[model samples]
Target: MNRWFMTLLASLGLLLIVSGCSTKKDEAPKDPKAAAYDFSNEKSFVVYGEGIAPVHTVSPAQAIVLAKRAAITDGYRQLGEKLYGVKINSSETVKDAMIRDSRITAQVNALIKDAAITDATFKDGLYSIRMEITMSARRWHELFSY
Candidate 1:
């Protein structure tokens, strides 16, 4: 009888272990941005941007509002970076040269204004925004045609 009881207990333990191992609850949370858009195609590029706001000495609502604004601005900046590549300059370059002389930056900023803000989140006193801009082949040509 004791042998049968031990066998039953061992079987139950094995069953529990197998069940736990097969469960999917341990999987990492999927990115919210990826869920909204398909990223596998080569035609579109996906980028993420984040902004942080402090909760100290501020109301919760105020913190959230500030963080969200910061996050949206950050998203626009990120989109601009993608549309217009960053310029690397030597130390000898003038401090205001790029801002004063470059029209590319202004053009990119104009494009970024039209980008879609796909996702925004406020968590742990930090706000994150994700912007998606589609650049199709025709659009690419049109941009360069200007």
Candidate 2:
């Protein structure tokens, strides 16, 4: 009876393992908003970012340049977030069943290559930039392998 029970348990475990195995190619993005875009119909991803001129800038030209640089940086950050999902760390302290302190942090790390700035404009002391990157099905896998 003991040997029969062990065999049955091992078979069930093996079945579960086999059923859980899945290929990475079919896995979809975890973010629900990702569903809005029909990636199958498109070959690239697009992101936009805006930056405002700081009050302390010396000249209008300098302010414009600064804002444009900031806008480019913002666009890159957005790309990183989309490619590599954000890492969130949270902690909470409870005293007498009441939460005393809580903290949450998010971080993203990604390597963006061959991204092109399609549109850029400065208006009313603000700079806006649109960035697009060409991504292939297997392109992302090559990014982190290095």
Candidate 3:
């Protein structure tokens, strides 16, 4: 009986080890929205006719704040549903939040392909990002109205 029990315990341990080793790695998703922007022209340059204004630069602190705020504004109101009315769990790391936020932005960009949301740039502190999007008035109306 003692030998049988030892054999059973060893088999269970081996099974658990094998099962754990078979766990798959988490894959980073390829964004379909990004696929739309892929092209052969890699060294593209913007030509200014001395008419366009320069772009603005946002600081890191401002970027983080903007990112958090934009996450809420862009239909992700789940963060605010906790008892505190706006509870971003203190235990959650900023890196984890940023990764999730980036994924959300990618998915949203995919759905709004007509808008041609080509790219996004984030400053360090801002929760919001500056997005480059192109779309006709008709397309915009159709998207939001639907």
Best by lDDT: 2
Q: How accurate is candidate 1 locally (lDDT)?
A: 0.67
Give lDDT tens digits, candidate 2, residues 1-146.
99999999999999988877843657887777675443464357899989999889789889999999999999999999987778999999999999999999988888788999999999998999999998754554455334
Clashing pairs in model 1, backbone N/Cα/C closer than 3 A: none
Worst 10 residues of 1 by lDDT: 101-110
Q: Give the Cα-based TM-score of candidate 1 against the true structure.
A: 0.51
Backbone clashes, candidate 3: 20
Give the Cα RMSD of candidate 2: 12.9
The runs of at least 3 residues in candidate 2 whose Cα sits more than 4 Å from the true structure, single-residue gaps closed, are 1-42, 138-146
Candidates 1 and 3 compared: the better one by TM-score is: 1
User: If scored against the real structure, what TM-score would every candidate get?
Assistant: 0.51, 0.63, 0.22
lDDT of 1 by residue, 1-93 (tens): 999999999999999999989989746449865443543333454566677786584687877888888888777777667767566543333
Candidate 2 displacement at residue 105 in angstroms? 1.2
Sequence-dependent TM-score of model 2: 0.63
